[model samples]
Structure formats: structure tokens, C-alpha cells
Target: MTQSTANFKVGNEKLIKVLDGASSHLRGLLEKQGRPDGALRIAVIGGGCSGLQYKMDLVDGPRDRDILVPSNAVNVVIDPKSALFVSGSELDYSDDLQQGGFKVTNPNAVVTCSCGESFSA
Candidate 1:
């Protein structure tokens, strides 16, 4: 199936809510850093014990083949390789005292480690 064909049981409204929440925090961070030019890139790499890991970084430039997912306020870029692993993923930001920040909810995951940083495909 195509990358976009991956099904997300979550409703669009809810997905947008989560995306919006993430955008807000990212934008805030960029603003505090003086509004650099570029997008926040999210990627899943192979390294963690579970064999896959999630990572986020601010990229001032995007190479060709980067997938762009734009919200009303933010643009999220993911490399094609990573796109395959996170096709149906939703990124959300949490500010809870215990655990917080950009949390990726990936339906493609078969299992995730307790730290929520690694997963099995």
C-alpha cells in the first residue's frame, strides 16, 4: 500500500487537535530561538533496543524527497525513508509534570518500550 494509504482510526478533528498542540509548542520554541527559517523534521531511525526510534529536530533546510505535512501554523517534514515507518503517526505535545514534549502516537508500532522512545515494527 502507498504511504498515504495507511489507516488512522483517529478522527481528523482529533488529529488536527494533536497537530495543533504540537505546532504551538514548536512555534513557541522557534520564536524563543529568534524564528529561524525552516521546519521541524520528525524521523524514525533504527537504533533503539526495539530496533526503531523516534526523533525530532529543527532543520533549516530540507533535502529532496522530504515529505511535508503542513498545519495552519507549522510545517512538519519527514524524509521518505522515515515516512514509511510513520505513515499513520500523530505527533502531540504534552506539558504534564511527569512526562511531556513531542509524543508520537504511531499506529504502525507492534510494541513500544516503556520509555516510549523505541518501538517494534
Candidate 2:
């Protein structure tokens, strides 16, 4: 690959941002699961009203070709295709009872469902 191409890919490696709240929450979750070395896996899935949704899980680490992003001392793993949809997105955490959980603020989403968990990019 050309130098510019390689530089571009490296630039996009940190496309997703994890907020302070998300980092803290995720770190707690990892500790609770007894996985200090674990990482959070974020993936886009089908079935939401907007045609896409996020499915997250805690895994041991990144698999082959998985993009690993370290932000706020937390490790996040995302696949290549999902990276496209979630580029420039920020991950945050909420502790409210009504809307409590990890949330994504994605700039690429053109439309979103009422549940706030699904979107069309």
C-alpha cells in the first residue's frame, strides 16, 4: 500500500471514542466478570426498526483482523465492517433507571429508531 493509504488507515484506527463514563462502567464490568484482561466487543447487527443495531459483549481480547482501540484505559474491539458504520461515534454510559446502559452517539446515522438503540447509516 502507498504511504498515504497506510497513514489513512492508521488515522481511522482511533475513530471510535469512549467517554469517561463508559470507560469507568466498562472497567467495572470487566472486573465483575473476573476478566481484568478482557475487552469489550462492539458489533453492528440486523433486526432493529432502522435496519441495524448494536450488539456488545465482553471478550478475552481481539480476534484476528479485529480493530482494537484503547481509550480511557479500556480496550474496545470492533470488526472492520462495523467500524464503517460506527466511525466518529462516541460511547457513553448512563446509570438512570429509565435509560440506563451504554449509548452510542454516531454521526453516520441518518435515521434512528424510537428506542435509540437502532439506526440507519
Candidate 3:
């Protein structure tokens, strides 16, 4: 297995928190896709209304520069570069009437779009 150079902690908590709703949603998706062993990979990439966007996916395993963070019962993986942008973020799920999906609460973000889908640090 490839090793990671990224640090996985921020103050008293892990870099990110995969809340129960998000973890359950991820587990269900993985089960349906027959990839129960898969992990949720969260990365920040260029391009969005606010300049930076969050890209998430269910990955089979960790890459060479991935920081593995265990949250709830889910494994949250972050690339080294993305890790810096989301160091003190929380991965959560929302089931509201209008907007419902996985949301990233990132403390490192200096400015975020109105929809909360993108941000700039």
C-alpha cells in the first residue's frame, strides 16, 4: 500500500468529521455499487463560482499522498493538497426540503458562495 505524507489532525479533532448521516449515506451508496470496502475521497479542486470547489467520490483505496481519516464508521481520504484547504472541515449530510446533500463546513475558507458549494481561502 502507498504511504501518505499528509497530517490527519486539526487541534482536538481529526481533520474532518464524517457525521452519521453522511456516513450512512456513503455506506448505502457503496453497498449498492458493490464496493462496501470503498472510502469517501474528498478533494478541493479549481473551478467554481467562488474559485475552489469540493470534489467527492467513493474510491476503492488510498492514493500515495492521501491522508486517511476515520470518522464514525467511514474512512475519509484526502489528498495532500486538498488536505490543506479543508484541515478543519466537517463533512455532513442534509435532508432539507429544498437543498439536501453532503456539505463541507470548512473553517479555512475565507469566502464561500451563497449556495455553499464553493469557496476561496
Candidate 4:
């Protein structure tokens, strides 16, 4: 894990809650990818059907000015800007044949796309 030189506090496990399913899946993915020490990065990006979408990636660790949250024994990192959109959100996973993937339930979102891949806050 890369250490940030900044001194500001970034620990906020409550920012986005990671459900059991999501945590388990993320841990497995990190292990398979040979990055058990890595963290999951969640960001809000524009250009989705609803004007906003979520982008996730497995990263080595939190960067400078990044918020590092620990939930369900998993580490999740978010940039300062992306934190605004994902605050008070919940991340979950599903193994259903049709909707099998990670999903974020954001309380700030007022409208979500029918595909469940985008939202408007």
C-alpha cells in the first residue's frame, strides 16, 4: 500500500457501507488478481445514461487527497470529488444470473437509469 504524505484525516468507514456480498467478492477478486493488499476504488464519472455513472477499479492504495474507508474488512478508496456523490451509499453484490455484479445504492440519487448502471443526484 502506498502511503500518502498528507496529514489530513481520511478514515471514514461510514462514508459508503460495504455489504457482506460486496466485501467477499472484492476480497476474492483482489486475491485472484494477486493484489490482496490492494484497495477498491469507487468514483463517480459523467457520461452515463443518467448523466452520472460509477467507475470501480482495484488499486494499490489511496492516493494523496484520497479518502480511505475500511468496511467489512475491506479497504475502499475514493477521491475527494467522487466522495460527494457516493456519501451515504451502500455497495452490494449479487450472483444472480441476470444481475450478477457490484451495485451501489446511493441515497443522494434522485433518479436511476432503468439499466441500473447510472443515476442522477
Candidate 5:
């Protein structure tokens, strides 16, 4: 993985708290899922019901174009391609069963679904 000089900051208190919680959950899931060296990867991809969708997973390796951010003892990797769509966005986790799990709040999203899973930028 090529580390760029781009010192991206994972700001926002609520976002950080959410990321920390998500990191804890992800770490446990990864351990249970069985990959000691893996990390939680988040990306924006095309072709959802909307124009774009958020994609996340536990990945063991980083590609050349991935932008890396560290949060709560975990490495958060965002692909360079996806960064264009997700830049200036905040990641948050909701414990509410009705809207549980991680959620991405993108300032760049021109349109977003009620569930906040899909968007049009």
C-alpha cells in the first residue's frame, strides 16, 4: 500500500464515537469471522437502486489506490476511486435496532434513501 502525503483527518466527535463503536464491533466480528490481519474497508460503488451505494467489508489486503485511516485500533481503508464520492463524509454507527449498524453521512450526496444506504451524488 502506498501511503500518500495526504494527511486525511477522521474528524467529527459523533462520527469518531460511531467509528470507535463500529471498530469494536468489527474487530469482534473479524475475530469471529477469522482474520487476524484484516481491517474494515468502506467504499462507494456505482449501480445501486440509486446511482451509488456504500460497500463495506473485512479485507486482509489494501490495494494501491486505497486511502488509509486509523480509528479505534483499526485501519479504515477507502479506495481512491470511492474517495471522490465519500470525501468530506462522516461515518456513524447507530445502536438502535430500527437503524442499527454503520451509516455514512455524505455531504456530497445530492439524494439519499430513507435508509441512507443508497445515494446519488
Candidate 6:
């Protein structure tokens, strides 16, 4: 369960990067949930106003077809199907007054909702 950030590359391409704030937040959640070895799973599911929604959760391990991206002290797990939409995105954490939570800055998104929870590629 110990991985370095430099090991997050997929072939010759770099996968998503998790900012320090997001990694800290996720690590705290895993500790609180008593799953220090758990990983954060990010997936794209059909729903939301933009037709595709990003779903995230803490899981004990990666599922079949998952791409493991390590960042700092946390590991981000994304399924292959979801990776198509989230590739090159940054997993960030924000505490701004307007919006405060985990956010995805996706370059592939054609349109993203104001809430930052859903998008279309």
C-alpha cells in the first residue's frame, strides 16, 4: 500500500494528479474509517444534469480494470471506463467560501456544471 507519486504514470502518459490538500483529506478519511490501506475510487456513472457524474468513495482495494494512481500518501483508483473521461484531470480539494469540497478539473470536459460535480466530455 506504500507507493510513490512518481509511480502514477500510465505507460508514457501521466494520469490524474491529486493535490496535497486532496491527498491529506483522503488520508484523514481513511484513518477515520479504520481503513489505512484503503484507496479512493473515482468513477464516472450515467446521471446528473450533464449526463455523466463523477462518483468517489473509499474502497479497501481496486476492482477489476482499475487504474491505480498514487499521489503523496494516498492512492486514487479509477476504472478504465471512467479513466477515458478523467484522464489528465486534477483531483483537488478546496475550502473556498463559494465551494468547499473535492473537485475535478478535467481538460476533456466539454461542459461542466456550476456545482462541479458533473460534466460532459
- Highest TM-score: give the candidate number: 4
- lDDT per model vs. reference: 0.71, 0.84, 0.83, 0.88, 0.72, 0.83
Q: What is the lDDT of residue 63 in candidate 5?
A: 62
Candidate 3 segments whose C-alpha is farther than 4 A from its true place: 1-13
RMSD of each: 8.0, 6.4, 3.9, 2.4, 5.0, 5.1
Clashes of each: 0, 0, 0, 0, 0, 0
Name the 10 consecutive residues with the lowest summed lDDT in model 6: 4-13
lDDT of 3 by residue, 1-121 (tens): 9955443432223588888899899889888989898888888999899999999888876777578887788788888788889988888888887778889999989999977889999
- Predicted candidate 4 versus true structure: per-residue lDDT over 1-93, tens digit per residue: 995464324667568999999999999999999999888999999978999999999998888788999999899999989899999999999
Q: Is candidate 3 or candidate 6 better by lDDT?
A: 6
lDDT of 6 at 71: 75
Candidate 5's displacement at residue 109, Å, is 1.1
Estimate, for each residue in 26-48, the C-alpha lDDT of model 5 and write its tens digit: 77877887886676678788867
Error of 3 at 85 (Å): 0.3
Give the Cα-based TM-score of candidate 6 against the true structure: 0.85
Residue 57 error for model 3, in Å? 1.0
Please give, for residues 1-121, the per-residue lDDT of candidate 2 as tens digits: 6532111122233578899999999999999999988888899998799999999999988776678888778888888889889989999999989878999889999999877799998
lDDT measured at residue 5 in model 6 versus the true structure, 0 to 100: 40
Displacement of the residue 68 alpha carbon in candidate 3, Å: 1.0
Order by lDDT, highest first = 4, 2, 6, 3, 5, 1
The true-versus-predicted C-alpha distance at residue 39 of model 4, in Å, is: 0.7
lDDT per residue as tens, model 1, 1-121: 6534332122222222237788788888877777555567778888887899988888654556676666646767777777778777778888977677788888888989876789988
After best superposition, candidate 5 residue 15: deviation in angstroms?
Answer: 12
Q: In model 1, which residue pairs have backbone atoms overlapping below 3 Å?
A: none
For candidate 1, the 10 contiguous residues with the lowest summed lDDT are 7-16
Those runs of model 2 whose alpha carbons end farther than 4 Å from true positions after fitting are: 1-13
